[model samples]
Target: MATRSAPPSDNLLARIALRFTAFTERWLPDAFGFVLVGTVIVLLLGLATGQSPTALIDGWGKGVWSLVTFTLQMAMIIIGGYALATARPVARVIAWLATIPRTPRAAITFTAAASMITSYLNWAFSLIFAAILAKEIARLVRGVDYRALGAMAFLGLGTVWAQGLSGSAALQVASAESSPKAVQEVIKAGRGTGLIPLTETIFLWQGIVATLIVFVVAVVTAALIAPSGERAKTAADLGIELKPLISPLEAEPKGRPGDWLERSPVFSVLIFAIGAWYLVRHFVNATGSPLNALDLNTINLILLLLALILHWRPHRLVTAVREGAPAAAGVLLQFPLYGGIFGMIAFTGLSATIAGWLVDISNPVLYPALIAIYSCVLGVFVPSGGSKWVIEAPYVLDAANQLQVHQGWMVVVYDLGEASANLLQPFWMLPTLAVLGLKARDIMGYTFAMFLVCFPTVLIVVTLFARTLSFP
Candidate 1:
């Protein structure tokens, strides 16, 4: 890793953060273990809610397969994104970006901002994109703490991601077909429409403002507490080596016809040409902003096509993808466990019961705050913004109608809380952890700091600015 010397000192806050890191390093289990325990917790919660053991078991079994498609999509982003980044041209761009930040604090600020801005486009893509950026920044910037960089790479998911274009609730309610029937009814009653448009949800000026405030708060906090000097644990200090990606698909001067094909660009160009046409069509027929047109498959298609063009050979891209597969293993194993947890909460009526109690105590003034907290808390268990939002929209939007609050604002509120919990959840941290070759404990301290700064920033932004996106 290149260094301009060492990162400057901020031992005061660094010392405090180190204490938390130490505790987590000592006690926090592997993320897979965390999910297993969460499964147990959800099981217990279901049983305590008077659900039959048979019912809970059935839900658990059934729920395990519910997120299978989503799991594959997440896995693709990791593998495909890594392949794209390791391409020579993309690596060069990243290398140039790394040189831009001369100091550790500036590096962290840039990373956090990059993560948030890209996440605003698409959270899944942002995870792998920012993770790659953070690693490159850590490589070029001396004295930058790897843990802080890793956390900043992940800050996108927990901070402003759910408030952006790909946010599940916003997009779900933006279309009547995608919206749950209950939520559709709520929207009709509240807005005199069958769906809540993104114009009224994520695209609302207040949501945009709140997203910006969160971006600043998180970036500032990350820079302020970024470790330096003796407190810094750069990637080298942690014994992690940065290795350049190499392709095994190089041309063979004396080999068979298959070797020639492996090294040729014909297949890749053919595929890329097809994908490019589809991308143009996708955006041209897009419903909202072009940014909103970025769903998971669309993003993966773009990444795949870019990687194909960059590698310029079908087999070379295959090698890059194979190298990236291990990073997605965590998602493969843990998501099903979370799927079961989602099933337990949804089928056993645990979520509705908990939401019911919250509804009883909430009036309009406290409603947004309550929903934010509720979404954050629920997010830890479910960990899926899209599917979980489907489960939440009915009761959550229903309560908004009852309280006479702007129903669309509640989506923003729910998103705020949903994202806040990700800092502590460790679920979405898998991609960053894998890319950086670190454990969840290694980065949780910085993410915890992010939560402290971003969560309250979100709550206040929503409660005070409710009128800006006022309901009917």
Candidate 2:
């Protein structure tokens, strides 16, 4: 692997951050190992909650495979996204962005903005897009801090994804059919509010405003603390070499008909034609709304189609996908472990126990804030936004009704907290790190810095906006 340059002596904050980054690099385990440790911690928590070891083991066994579909979806997202990023047009765009950031300061800020905006469109897209963009920036910018730029790009997701179109919690609450069990229970209890429209949640003026604020603060934060001089990483520090996707071998003659087929665009174009039809059909079938059609599977299919169209040849797309697969292997290996942990939490009633305590201590005025805090804590363990909401929503909804707080406000609060807590969670960073050929340690310190800056910002934003919604 590549080595970073020495930390700068002049900037105290930069020096401290570099030291911290080095410390984490030296001490932190690989992403798979880190999640394995997290699984063990969750197992202990299950046992502490009076679950029998035998039952907990069984729950883990069952839970480990529960996310099979989701795992495939996530893996497709990474692999497909990476392939899409390698497309000629996409590479040109990245090259253009890379040239724009003439300095280290501009590099990180541009990365932050690009990541935030793209991630708002689709979280999966954000992962590979930002990493690829950062890689190009590192290649182009002379003094760019590679590690910092990588971390900042990754940080952009947690900073704004919860308020975006693909946000699991917001979308979940917006759809009655897919709403969490707790939300359903609230309806049965006569205390639950009806389905919240996306307009009232993710598309609300406050949420939009808050997301813009986060984007601005994140850019400013990047500007303030970006390492300079010796502290920054050159492209050489990456240790990995960058290559254009267009191979010279592709221009050489193919040996057989199958080889010719693979090199031809006909197959890919045909596939895209079918996929495009399906997508159009899907959206048309939706009752005059497309937001309901947005989800992991849909996004994955669309991305696959885009990649095929952009790459223009079956063989090239296949090669690009193969190259990208390893980056997603961490997710494949660890999500089952996470699934096991989820099983223990869900089966053993630990989620309810924790939520119950929060309800017990919460009052009307403090309910939203407390729930937001609770969501943040829970988010660390169950970083899957939709799943976390499933566990927290029932009790939180019941409690909110009793406290006379608006249920929509509760969803907003949970969304903010969940996204904020992901700042500290490394699970979501695996693909980006893998793509960048870096470890968690390289990015942890910077991401932690982002957390310090964003967590409070999110809390304050949620509180203020929630108050407005509740009062109105």
Candidate 3:
């Protein structure tokens, strides 16, 4: 060129900055903004409400401790499960699962059943397992779109719906915070000393019926809304010619039967033992001292240490840890920011204010439905089930007390809200997106429609069920 390009003018630079800011607002961690803004309001409230600075500091301290414990537990579940899933251990489990049946219909049914079963073990684990299994099934089916398969896998896993009904971490925490005595009575009634109500015959039956409705609704909606035309045609076009069977490379790794025990039997035993211990400990505590102290956190820490020791050196544990760390890094980084956001909310009394408003709006007859809506909204800010429980549980309990709402029903509402919102929030969908190599915008287009359809159905059914049972 004859002349060099002129430097950008100030107005042009300002315009560029404005556009960049707008772009960030659209794509960046908008979820984080919810928490941040809430925190600021909390701090201002604390200051305006004439609360002592010391009290604010103390509350912040408590919040930090809670965050640390919750994050650690979550990290263990995510990292341990991820490592196991990607390694030889989970391959064996899937191999056994595959042997049961590999048909498209069977894959759907088995995935749905296994999801419910494993969700109690760990929600994160269940989700990861289901995602991996779905991918495998899609590969086997050849012409099937992986995205469609992913959606099916998500629905079948039932992580969101089941978490609301019973035996979910969020529900358990809500139960404890709301009415320790009622939770105890539930345990005594043989509800198994978890978040789920003790009236298994009644509560579980209702839950099962409600779960079925959700299942059918989800499947139908997924089928109808699944992309059509070129995308759908491509998958359909390949359907007939595409092999119904998977190649050895695509299937779970299988080895000599005896050798299978050598590579991962220890981890298998550890997982089983830990689960057994958790259940046994819960049962013992229910019968004996309520102060039962079997620290699952400590157990998880010990298991991780053992994984490092046993799988170190010859097993290349370092590489596994390295690879695994990246997967968890996003969670680890975002969690602290989330904690700060929670801190600000607590400081400003925003959570209490919001919860109070929700309680005020709720009527005895329509309380469950209202609670569900509130939970869904709060879920946008606090996506982690455990963390959401910790921050919102106190306020929810207060609201329940004030509203004379049944704690179990309230827990149900909280579960539905938290779980349903997961499909929309970028944070929860990241893992699914990562697995599929899809963008957030693309994934949201599908999940958003799913959310709109499922959210109302869940609200209506859970509310009606709660009323019929005379749930408090």
Candidate 4:
């Protein structure tokens, strides 16, 4: 155990967090392990509640593939966001940013701020960019702790991404076609189109305030608890081979007819034009605020078109997306398993039983906080935000409806909890870990420290902000 690893930091939080890091380094299982284990636990729980094994098996089999369409949307969240972030211009901007932070503290704070900001735009983009930016910052800034940098780089996903534009739950609920079973119930309950627009979710004034508050808290917390002096571990001290973030397209040979077509701007421009026209027409046709037309499909299409134009060539964009495609591999693999879990709960009486447990414990005033805490705990073990929401939403939102809670607030609440747990769950840390050549244990200490701060901060914000939103 690294509890006695003679770490360099004297900061009380840093010391405390490393104890958790030491523990997790020894015992933490792979994210897939969590899913497999979760499947069993849920099955057992169902059986204990009087659900037959045959029925549970039937539900699992039927539900395993039920979310195929929704799965694709979630996959695109990573691919589209990756392509957009790695575009030459964006990459250039990130490189320029690295040149600005000279001191260790500034470097840490800047990385956190950048990660949170870009994550709020698209989490996949933020993850990649933060990794690249941290690498550059570490090269330039002396005495900066690499682990702290990695943790700061990861703050965006754990803090405010879910409250931002590419947030899965918010986007899912915003589209009637994409809204899951629970949201469909909401729709049936007379939410008009049964769609909660972005305007009422992430873009709401209350949500915006919550996001800003959380962002400031996270950045500040990162700066305060970051290790320094003899306690810090630099990339060099850790013996990591730092590599520059290069465009994946830089390696391809030129000259073949196919290669020429790939490199040519014509196809990219044509596709982008077609996509842009549709987006414009979509807003033009909107019956209410044009922004309400922004949904899961709209966001994905916009990301696709933006990436195409920014890359300026089919080959470059395709290569960029392909490089980032592996990042989505986890989602493709785990989502079906989650769908099965959802099936067991949603298709069975397990949902009401679960809802009853939640309702039994929380009144409307405390319900949001309870849901946020529960979501955070579940997120540590099952980090599939979109699919996890699908599994829990049927019961969670059902509980909210029972208490006459604002359905949209439930989405916001779920998002807050889900993001907070990302602080502890390293599932989404694959890209950052790869980019930094670091293991989950190295940076987890800092993230764990951040979680200690953020988890409570989120609960308070969710509870206090509950009044600012209500069911329409």
Backbone N/Cα/C clashes per model: 1, 0, 7, 3
Whichever of 3 and 4 has more TM-score, that candidate is: 4
Across residues 1-472, which tens digit of lDDT does each residue of candidate 1 receive? 2333333456455666666676777888889888988899888887887888988898888899899989999899999888988898887777777778899989988998899998988888788878888988888888898988898899989988889878888888886556778778877887788687788788888888888898888877877878777668899989999764333444447668768878789888888999999899989887655654777888788888999999887777898899899999899998898899888887777888889889999888888988898889899999998888988888888788888889878888988899999998789999879988999989887787678778888889889988555566
Give the TM-score of each candidate. 0.94, 0.92, 0.65, 0.82
Report the Cα lDDT for candidate 1: 0.84
Per-model CA lDDT versus the true structure: 0.84, 0.79, 0.53, 0.78
Q: Which stretches in model 3 have alpha-carbon errors above 4 Å? A: 1-66, 87-89, 93-117, 151-197, 200-204, 232-320, 390-404, 431-439
- Candidate 1 least-lDDT 10 residues: 1-10
Listing every candidate in turn, what is its Cα RMSD in Å to the true structure after a full C-alpha superposition? 3.4, 2.8, 10.7, 3.9
For candidate 4, lDDT tens digit of each residue in 311-353? 8978788887888787777668877887787677657777567
Please estimate how well model 3 matches the true structure, expressed as its whole-model Cα lDDT: 0.53
Model 2: worst 10 consecutive residues (lDDT sum): 243-252
Best candidate according to lDDT: 1
Sorted on lDDT, best first, the list reads: 1, 2, 4, 3
TM-score of 2: 0.92
Candidate 2 lDDT over 141-232, as tens digits, reads 78788888888778756778878888887787767667856577684464335566787777788878878888888777777668888767
Where does model 4 exceed 4 Å of error? 1-9, 70-80, 168-205, 236-239, 246-259, 286-301, 318-322, 378-408, 431-442, 467-472
Better of 1 and 2 by lDDT: 1
